[model samples]
Target chain A: MEHYNMNLTLKVWRQKNASDSGKFETYPVKNISSEMSFLEMIDVLNEELISEGKDPIAFDHDCREGICGACSMYINGRPHGPWHANTTCQLHMRAYKDGDTVVIEPWRANSFPVIKDLVVDRSAFDRIIQAGGYISVNTGNAVDANAIAINKDNADAAFAAAACIGCGACVAACKNSSALLFVSAKVSHLALLPQGNPERKTRAMNMVAQMDKEGFGSCTNTGACEAVCPKEISIENIARLNREYMMAGASADK
Target chain B: MKWSELFTSSIGKKWVMALTGLFLIIFLIVHAGINACIWANDGGVMFNKAAHFMGSTVVIRIAEIGLFLGIFLHIIQGLMLEFQNRSKRKKGYEVPMGNKGSKWYSRSMGLLGTILLLFFILHWWHFWVPARFIGHEELTEIEINGVHMHNMYNLMQYTFQELWVVIAYVIACISLCWHLIHGFQSAFRTVGVSNSKYMALIQNVGIGYSIIISLAFAMMPVSMYLGWV
Candidate 1:
């Protein structure tokens, strides 16, 4: 197999701060190996910018692989580039051809405001998770792990829901900027488990209420969130969230 | 926490859309059933009698006001939501995924709604103004055993004979089908009827209702166009 190299033009969003207006700045990177990941290609451009003593483009990343999901970029009009259920870190350069111009931008939802070039302050997500993402952890002797016999299907579904990495890709992909997928994933993961049963009602209600407070738009079931979610979290999780919230609202503790 | 939050909040707005949408759906059912009586082929006797009762009855007259208000509320709230959703993304993608990401009608609800609104205005112009305000003096009046009634069936027959009006109706019914496809199940979801066991049932019911009701509506004109009735 012969190695392929491409010279690409990058139109990257450059934002000074959260309050600053942003614009796209063009940069050219040459001789990029097709095998390099999309982020690694960006690294080459950052290296050149640093050598010239210019402020390098700022972005977020942790694991180079897809799991961490710290890497998020709206590349060429898509969250995580033009790939099915992939993170930006996992996108390889071979997806592009020589002389192709790639446009990169930060997630554009007001709820996930831009912090700098291609990086957004997704802390709103943290607040939503903080609202009710955790289960009741009673301070006592450690409970036996296998004490609760969980059904296999429920456990599998819960595990699938738990795979979400809080990437905000769902918000970026949603036309409404809705956090339904992320909130649903968190809600469904815990709602399916016995440990989560105690706070199930409040958890569902509070999480949704928090999500609403964050100014995220409503979910219209466009399925774009699931389409772009690296975890492939199902729309079924959203349905379950609605179920939980409804049950909570109708519950009468008085 | 404010009372206004029930209409302004995202979820509250959803509640308004859903409740108004479902209420309008009930109105559609009753309206469709009554119109279906035109198929009785009894020279519009039963249809005219039913129309007379609906027009003359005070309870139904009061409910008609609620129906009109519900429709207006649904339209206004839907426009607000559509604008809100649009404003959420101030920029457009360089390459939209289009149907690859979501259904066309899902994203085009605002556009479909506008079409429906225009169609509805035309609908009211053709029938409602004539029946309620113009005194039905010019309309063909019939007596069924000495009971006075407007021959609404003749009104419909005359209305549907025009090809353009029939075409407009067919297009309007198509839009209604797509609107109901998402709206029906979505309304239920917003109201918290999202149980997995029953959601499948609800979805099927939604699709079934969309197809049957829209087709029923479209057929009214198509049948008249073809002189089937």
Candidate 2:
């Protein structure tokens, strides 16, 4: 493949803080390599802004390899851009052409408030995880793999559900701003395991309760979350979450 | 933790929507089946007889209350959901990828529901009030095997004869098709039917159900207007 260079117009959301009313600030980047990742393109832009004696745009990134789930910027109208099953950091410049205008903004949901420019406080996810997205198992004693016989299909579903990186892309992509996909993925991964049995009764209820407490919208089953999900987590997990909630509610003494 | 939380929470609100929505789905099927009897072409006697039994039946009369409740709860929850969803995003994208992002109906459920609401009011005024409250004395009442039945068939014929009413009904049914297309599978999904195999089955059934019910509904008025039924 021949190496190509393109000049692009970047329209980015600029906010001084969560309290500040934000606006789009446009800048022109010249001679950008086609092979650079989307975040890398932003880096180049930031470097330019810094050299021009201006404050660099703030965005979040830890594992640019698409593992951390930290790089969640809504490119254009689609979350994580027009790419499918890829995060913002994994997006390449080749998806765009010369003279194209790229609009970038942070995840838009009341639950995930904007902390700075492109970095929103996704700690709501953390709060959900903390709210019973776990299991209690004794450690320091290595058990045989055969100790727990897991079904092949259930194991695969668990693994797939576990692939959720806690990124807010699912929320960003949702039309209703629902977090069912993310919470369901977390719930499914644990509920499928024998170890997750003890808390299974309260897990879905508590997490969903917390999700509502955080002011996230309800799932309309639009599947936009699954469509934009980097891990391609099945909406099946959401069903599992609902199943868990129903079971918990029916069995709870209260 | 409280019992009320089940319907108060976001997930709970969805449950309310799904359960009430499923009830309406069943109601539509029954309503459509009964309305389809107009095609019997037996001087409207059979249709009116059946309508009288349904109207006089204690079970169905009680069910009418439940049906209204279901519709009411569905509308209330749907509106609340719409408001919450809109508020969740205080700011929307300047360049929205509308259809590219998701199906238009999925995003427009609120609008469709509102249209259906107006349709419901018009529908009740045209049919229910006369049959139940105002009395259907003006129309001919036919007695079948000593059981008197309201001449709803004539009422329907008169209602559907007007082009404007027919057009309104046809438009309402189209809105209903979109609503059912999203609502059917969505209700199942909300209730936790997420397996790939089951999801596909439910989606297919949903599509078929929407098509049949919508076509059945829209065709009634069209058929009446054309004097076929």
Candidate 3:
């Protein structure tokens, strides 16, 4: 692996809370290793903050692995830094040149209010999911996984949908703030599988209603979500979600 | 806000966008088909008859309401999604790497959409509103073989006779075609039909349909102006 030492300028957002007006504060770091992950660089900055008798900048993180969907940051203009299918934590300094200036900010959206510096409230996503998702599976029954016998085709589709980590990266990448990619993945994952059939209609209807209620934008058929998705989720899932929604709307009176 | 439930779960705003987009796709196909009928005959008789029928009582009223709702839902949802996505973008670090996976049109849907909106306004002002309220006299009147037609044919011919009008129509058709190319497949994908086994086939079919319909509709006026049936 290629290694290099680099000096960098960081312009980071500083926010006290959701209501506070945020601003960018610049910090300089010298002699950073090329192998350091983006979050590790933030860790170094936070350490400096603590040493300076300042409150360390707060940001969300879990699983330093890219799967948890907790560490969301817009690097430059793109959703998850520069690398395709990689999250902020997975982004290595090698992707940047020495002496590069990096601007780091929390995700900007009305629905995702700023929680603090570098972290925003993404809980609107939860309300949408809770409104509709998951079939009313019985707790007592331990049905064999193979017993349901999902087609390999459906299984593959579900696996693709399951790849969505709920990162909201798609929302960030989209110009319209559309969440169709994320929601459709979830809907399609279940809808394509027979196991999800029982609640398919309700799931589509309720989830869509919840999404609209939360004041998210409609899909414009732009593939930005797929473009920036850390998991590389396809817009196909969104189409599936649409089909499910139509069917659900048609049968809503039932 | 329950943080655990939000980022950890799917089935949120994304699905709503997908669904609404797909619905609009259906509407576009139907609308394109209706518009294509304008070029079906040498004279505009068949087209005007069809337009008249479409502009008739019950169907027209239902279509008006549906169109309003459809456009409203699409715009509202599109804006919300953009906002949500904006909130999730990573902060301040430029990547020199070019966008690899997305199609050009997919990335530029907003621009195309804006163009389409402008076209819609012009379309309404030129055709729909005048046809509905102003009648043919204010626009242009045409009589062919003793038929007291509304002169929609003459109007179309006259409009396309202008070079700028022809160019505008072509540009609008291109935009519509590009929009539909992505929109059609996207709708299918959102509704869960994206399988690699048939993904390319479906994409091709979707693109074909979009191009054919948009080109057919756009070509009607061009043909009229060129005096080519």
Best by TM-score: 2
What tens digits encode model 2's per-residue C-alpha lDDT throughout B1-229? 6678766777777788999999999999989988888999887777787787787778998998999999999998788779878899887776775775578898889999999999999999999988878865555576778876787888888888799999999999999999999999999988888777888999999999999999999999999999997
Candidate 3's residue-wise lDDT over B75-114, tens digit each?
6655554445444433422332135446778766666777
Clashing pairs in 1: none
Stretches of candidate 3 off by over 4 Å are A132-148, A192-198, A252-254, B1-157, B160-164, B187-199, B209-229
Residues A1-254 of candidate 2: C-alpha lDDT, one tens digit per residue? 56699999989999999899989999999999999999899999999999999989999999899999989888888888888899899999999889999999899888888999999999999999999888887888888879998898889899999999999888988888889999999999999988899899888889988898898888888878888999999888888888888878767878
What does the i-RMS of model 1 come to? 3.1
Q: Which residues of candidate 2, in runs, are more than 4 Å off?
A: B136-138
DockQ of each candidate relative to the true complex: 0.46, 0.71, 0.25
Model 3: docking quality category:
acceptable
lDDT of 2 at A2: 60
For model 3, residues A55-161, the per-residue Cα lDDT tens digits are 88798889989999999888876777889889988999998888788888777656667889888788888887787667767788798877777788779879989
Clashing pairs in 2: none
lDDT of 1 by residue, A5-84 (tens): 99999999898998888788999999999999999999999999999999899999999889987998988777898888
Order by TM-score, highest first: 2, 1, 3
Q: Candidate 1 vs candidate 2: which has greater lDDT?
A: 2
